[model samples]
Target: MSGTSEGPTPAADLNRAVITHSDLDAPPCAEPLPYRSVFAAAPLAMAVVDPEGLVVSANATFGALLGTPAEKLAGSVAADLMELTSDARSWHSYREVLGGRQARLRCTRRLKHPEGHSVWAQVTVVPLPGEGRGVLLSVSDITTRRELQARLRHLQMHDPVTRLPNRTLFFERLTAALDAESYERGGTGRIGLCYLGLDGFKAVNDTHGHRIGDRLLTAVADRLTRCADEAGYARANTPLVARLGGDEFALLVEHSTGTEQLADLAESVLTALQGPFDLSGRRLSVSASIGVVERHAAGTTPTALMQAADTTLYWAKADGKSRWTLFDPERNAHRITRQALASTLRPAIERDEFTLEYQPLVGMADGTLSGVEALVRWNHPQFGTLTPNRFIGLAEEDGSIVQLGRWVLRTACRQARRWQLDHPDEPPIFVSVNVAVRQVWDSDLVTDVAESLADTGLAPHLLQLELTESAVMGSAGRPLQALQALSDMGVRIAIDDFGTGYSNLAYLSRLPVNVLKLDGSFVRGFQYEERDADRPSPADEVIVEAMIQLAHRLGLTVTAECVETSAQASRLRGIGCDTGQGWLYSRPVPPDRISELLGSPGVRTDVAGTP
Candidate 1:
């Protein structure tokens, strides 16, 4: 017998012990019987329902499950289950099972109990073997499990913070879309991915803390999602969105009817992100850089597609950021080569493959030697003698610049010391070395300089560290402090390529710097100066004079760089420029030639091999 209530069984009590089982089991009569028990029992509310959907019997467990006695459950029509608040789907399945169509049926149904609580149960009904007249129904509460499954599904498909599909799910859907495109009515089955990142994401994290950063990321996710939907042009289905990680997000646009579809989609994404995002009460405005890669035109593999997008994204960042770039294989190839080079740089350094040459900084007054700037070169085993331009930027990107910078600093200092030993009587000349931003940030730059000075016995005044204004400004918090400490340690600092960064004057006075090497743009103007040019081309001479005076006022020495003509040199000296460097002095050359030049008296006046 069975019941569908939460009370004990009254039917079994009234029926008393059936003599068939008890007597046959050998309890009261004689020998042990074979047929001990024939019925199955369930630890949940259950009852027997006839083919016409009437309750035939109620067990103790079923009575207890429904909070009613077995007597109350018996002889009730199964349709009366509606009084217990089962949903329509459950009732329909129950009827279907009773009609001889399904052998068993299970469903999650709601129950409104007398205790005023709504409960959920996994209800299973199966045909009883003893004749088709009855059915055994079992119910188990699985409300917790159902909810857990829902939560698990949510997490598996989406990012925890942004609530967007993660990389795994995005790629899965993307692969499916690409496969579908192959069979669909489209041109070359093209799609597009807009890989985007917030421009000032780090600043947001730093200034407002990560708590706010998380909120900002969520806001960005919403903005990107909306943009993706717009780009998708939905038409039932055309686009999917996902947050790859951090400030990075991706949008997959499918069945791109034309190449213009991708371009339009990119524009829409950019437009959407241009607006301000409201995060809590903070109206945060941020711009994103997007890298767009279209399928077929780009590639078919997932890796190739993502890489192309990433390369284009970097191009967006490189071209002043807060913009979009379409992937071009030719441009991406260069980027791939640079990435490969950056990864190989440290090992190359360890292999002792880097070399240095000196470029002269000539004195404008007499066209004589001032000093040489130490420039680095990489004698790559595969690609011969690469100049600083080829690898220094790469080093900076990979944070290998610190190690490379140390090498250049030490080597250049040692060479300066060697020159001093070779020409002891000559005026002590300075050897300017370029300092990478990574070196300033990672290493104890002051300590490196101090130790290098002591190790080489080179004077602190003779070793100048050349920094671009951008490098100084780019160094945040601790790195800025490091620069100050290094300056305080008596090492002369020169602002290389000066007049390039805006707002430089604000930091100029506070910086304990010694020299400003005017950027080549202004210096190159003097290259056209003719021997008989009237009164120094008033504009160039006046501008040069103004710069020199400004440097003098700031107590900073001025060095005119790229001084390639005699007339330019004379004009620079006339304008009170203290030093100059250019092809006019010497192109960067080998160390032995530098040593020989210092030894030859007449050669200094001609200004060849000065650096």
Candidate 2:
């Protein structure tokens, strides 16, 4: 080695020619411009080892990596100076570089310095353009670089909180496997996915804040990871757990043994998650619902597989959480239809496809119109005009009930104002609107009602809100506060569908409620009789009498709902029911029809008839 120094040798003096074996075999026609300058000036830590594994020359960085002087590096034997530990089998692997048979030999091994400090290096041996006498070696102290790359890979592919592969990496692996299956010589290929949701996760998040919720999720991930590790497959194919988001997670299983195997894995996951999470001072219980979708003989597309998993997961939730459900094409079709409907609802409202009809509430005493309950109808383009009974329950579940409820409030308020203006002296019959639980929670009910009243100039007293007893009873915290605020503004509050809820009469007086609309179930009992006459059935008279007395005691008015016949009306009137609304009076009619009935007392009296 010429000019053995501390810093890298000047590049101008270094060899720049790419040596070819054919040229090396031809001659040494020029002065021996030894490749020593090229080795010393190289950016990578480069060296040349003779057949005896002695270092002939080393780059500046190579000497620095080994903490040895570049001059001293030449005489040292490579194997003697370095400590090597690796899984790669043979030292002869490096000879390929010398004979120009192989391009490189890369291995991870520890390098021992003269000062006794150990360093990790990624050692690469490449054939120098020389005779089979010496080989070129490059050492990269990749400890920091490799560790950094490992950390970066972890951050990119795994969820920070759960340490599970995220959707991105999972999908990438799935797509790769799917591609491999496409070209494989095997007769057919299949992939399975298990979509999972944590049951009662929201309740836990609600009871305990997000911190504990995260801990619980971490615990769940750990359990799933353990299961994945225990699975016996070349790539550890139990399931690739991924947190899609929130309480939802998914798993990808390849070369699945069929539906039975997938189901067994799902069962294992559920069993693993069945235990309680001891999160920082909080013991929270959680279970998982799994939706399994196995590839059919016709094969599965990635989108279809994921969608089937999603649909099946919903089935698991619907079938009552903490269980597994297999994907069925027919069931998914129904779910897709419902999802389509839900997505279209808001746009329908925007397109002026919704309308309200008025159902008359008749005063039981005089047989006259006391008020009209505004019922919503959706004139859906695809499904035709749908009644509240068709979609109200679904709307409430999807949280679209809030927007729908607002529409109903505004429309009913506007109609009541019009009715008051048209009739001027008919004592201003109040218009009632049903409030769903979702509406109560999602909207500032007080502001909505107050604003509706102001916008339509409808009297607060003439605008009654009918909340189902369950809706009212389940309300607490902000919901109860909103209802109380509405009551303070002079709006009447009525509990609709009363008897079906828990009979907590204690809530009646305390909840600012003014009326209770007996549920139609109890009212139907007045006329229907059970098979065994000896055994008393749920009697309407007994329930009505008790309710009426209870209402009086609580200073609330009682209304019997679904009163259809003269006999039921008579029974209700005799029992002191203040108001009644049912099909007998008239079904829900358009605004014009309501006006027609209000204008003609003959029609009202004749409609009341024998009742």
Most lDDT-accurate candidate: 2
CA-lDDT, candidates in order: 0.74, 0.76
Q: TM-score each candidate.
A: 0.57, 0.57
What stretches of model 1 exceed 4 Å from their correct place?
Answer: 1-169, 177-187, 196-237, 240-251, 255-258, 269-289, 297-299, 310-323, 390-402, 420-430, 435-495, 498-516, 527-539, 547-557, 599-611
What TM-score would you give candidate 2 relative to the actual structure?
Answer: 0.57
- The sequence of per-residue lDDT tens digits that candidate 1 reaches over residues 346-435 is 999999999899987766666556688999989988778888888887788878898889989999999999999888888767899998
TM-score of model 1 (CA atoms): 0.57
lDDT per residue (tens digit) for residues 1-611 in model 2: 01111221222113225444443344447554445444557777877677667787677888888887777888787755544322334355554444556555666776666688667786766545445646666777877877788899889998889988888888787777677544274533667787999988899888888888899998998888776666545553556778888888887777666888788778888988878778887777888888998875345567777877887998898999899999988877766767777888878878889999888888888877878899999888777878887678778878888888998899999999998899876667789999987887787888889899999999999999998888788567997898889889999999999989886887776788998898898777787455854433456568778889989899998888887777788778878999888877778888988877665552243464322
Q: To one decimal, what is the Cα RMSD in angstroms of model 2 from the true structure? A: 10.5
10 residues in a row with least lDDT, candidate 2 = 1-10
